[model samples]
Target: MSLLHAELRLILRSRLAAASLALLMALSALSVVSGLSAVSRQEATIARATAEQARDLAAVAKAYGKPDGEAGYAAYYSFLLTHDRPSPLAFLALGQRDVQPTVLRVRALSLQQQLYESETLNAEQALPGVFDFAFVAIYLAPLVVIALTHDLVTSEREAGRLRLLLSMPGTGLWRRRIGLRYLLVALSLLIPAGVALVATSAPAHLGLGILTVPAVYLAFWFGLSLLVASRVRASATAAAASVGYWIALTLLIPTLANAAITRAVPVSKGIDLTLAQREIVHHGWDIPKAATFDRFLATHPEWRGHETFEGRFHWKWLFAMHQVGDEAVAPQVAAYRASLLSRERWTARLGWLLPNVAAQGILHRLADTNLVAQLDYQDSIGAFHKELRAFFYPYLFFDRPFTRADFDWLPSYSARTGTASWPAIPMLMLLVVTGLILAAGAAQMRRTGRDASR
Candidate 1:
């Protein structure tokens, strides 16, 4: 215990160790602040858009509201804007939100066409990726760990304490040394995260992020530190190998794998689905009205009785065709959605072996900023869009007056809530890895106890 204390004191007094710890803490804090600022900007944008939408809706009412004004004109002209607000913990992870559009404006136009358009982003900013807490933990923290622990064994040997320390009759010295170092590194990383979290008031997550990213990531680094330091004869070699491995594991592999998955999937099917749905909706003007109504009636037999039209133009026929248009691209939509989900599934599988990827999956999932969460938002958007069509379909088909009163009848956007449920499977995998590595390190430490003494 006294020796461990002496070592701790020695590390604190060392310029490199002190500077490294201070640098990591400072970086982590900066990342948290940056993430919070970015998210705040997004939320403000959403608020402004909501206000703008309200003004737009009022203009729509002024233009279209009349006892005689029809539902189709109002529905067509008025874009009901929808937005997904950032999850409270999004400051921590800033995942697909960078690439995915958070704010979307949609009208009675073919939803398939309007749905996939991404928000204007400087691809350059995103290409480098977010400078958020996820980045710090998954990428930078490992480097910090490497710097802190790469010399654990070799330093003692280099100091001429190897034979002497090993020969000292001790049962707990090795465990004590490893545990103390692990604690120091963990504290150095955690203090900054803790401070930032308190500053941001980042939400308590589903226990997934806590288990998977921060804790598991620490274990991974400490394990590598043990593995490299265990066999190395020199401190310099261990440090070099560990840092190189850290760079390759955290930066290179994940980026390369992501590129490969995207190229392989080629989810441009979303675009095809969009074009297909558009064709069906607009072609209704040229196609026989009866054909459009027949297609709509195929799915909605309940509305079949109302299919008969008495004039050259019935609101019912127009609305029915729109419904048919949406249905036309149903298979394509399913296929496109499947492809995206497949990518997420594969990412999880890869995460099992890659701690960086595993940490990413965990943190983003906790913050509800993961790719799956983005897909969930899209699913919700699609469902709400259907509701909008449903709400107006009756009014449109019945030739009901779409007055100011009817404007309020339009379905408002519903943002998803409570998507931060703990993903237990990934957390379990992380736990298993952590235990196995620590257990292995402990066993090896026992074997090295005498060598350290000698």
Candidate 2:
């Protein structure tokens, strides 16, 4: 305890160490606050959307709530609201939420067209990535570690204490110094995050995993710094080498990997699917109504007898045409989704070689704010669209009136539950890599001590 206390005092006495730690803590706290504020804004937006949707629905009911209300008219004009609420740990890593739409209004029409509509977003703001805890921990925190530990031995040697200190101390001198810095850096990054977890009432298991990620991530950086410090004689050279490693790991490698992955796995099929679906829907207007019903009935045989109507413009025919268009592009849609998942799988594989990517992936997965989470939300919306169709089919087929009371029977959409999965493989890979680095660092430190004694 006394040895650790002495090391702590020594570390604090250095202006660079003190200032670096203070700055890291401030950035960490600021990130947490920014994340919480962004989350609060999303919640408020969802609340306002829900309220506006209710008012819209009430107006629809007032207009078409008569005893003889047309089910077709009600289904056409009424738009149902769906939203992907942020996970409890989302403030830690906002992930794809910034680019993806959280709330959508869907009607009983061609779902493919509605699902792919893009919204206006500021490209400038999102270009640099979100300033969340993940960003701070993965990209910024390691520079602080480098600043604190790069001169661990060189600074002591330059101040004329190396020979005397080596002679007087037990063999635990390097361990004491390195361990103290590690603890200080970990606390500086994690204390603010811990407070955030408590404030958000995050699940205990998920919170534990979230806190564990930074500790492990920091260990890798600290170990690398220790190894560089032990091997390099000059403080400036060690700092340069450490920063160079940081740049390669966090910036250069990721950018190159992204380019490779994107070129190798092209996702242009998404635009192709959208255009194909639109074209199919557009062509439906020129074709015979019976042809549309026949295609729609191939999958939906339950509505066979109800296909006949008096006029050239029945709601059933119009809906069947739209359904047929969506189904027409089913193969393209499947191909597009498969391509996206392939890209995600490749990214995960890259994480094994890059610690920054691994830590970023783990944090986003724990927060339920990754590509998989966005895909899950889309799947949920798809399921609800099917339910919307089924709910109105009875009235459309049987010629039953969709009265005011029937509006009460509308099928409400429940957001997906239990979709946040633990990223076990990436986490395990991270731990193994960190352990290897720490072991190498410890061996180097031992060699340094022995050489100093000689």
Report clashes for each candidate as comma-separated counts. Answer: 7, 0
Query: For candidate 1, lDDT tens digit of each residue in 85-130?
Result: 8887887789988778878898765677787766334567778778
Clashes of 2: 0
My TM-score estimates for the predictions, one after another, are: 0.91, 0.96
Error (Å) of candidate 1 at residue 87 is 1.3
lDDT of 2: 0.89
lDDT of candidate 2 over 124-230, digit per residue (tens): 77687789999999999999999999998888777877776777756588777778888999999999999999987899999989889999999999988888898
Candidate 2: regions farther than 4 A off: 119-125, 167-171, 269-272
lDDT against the true structure, each candidate: 0.78, 0.89
The TM-score measured for candidate 1 stands at: 0.91
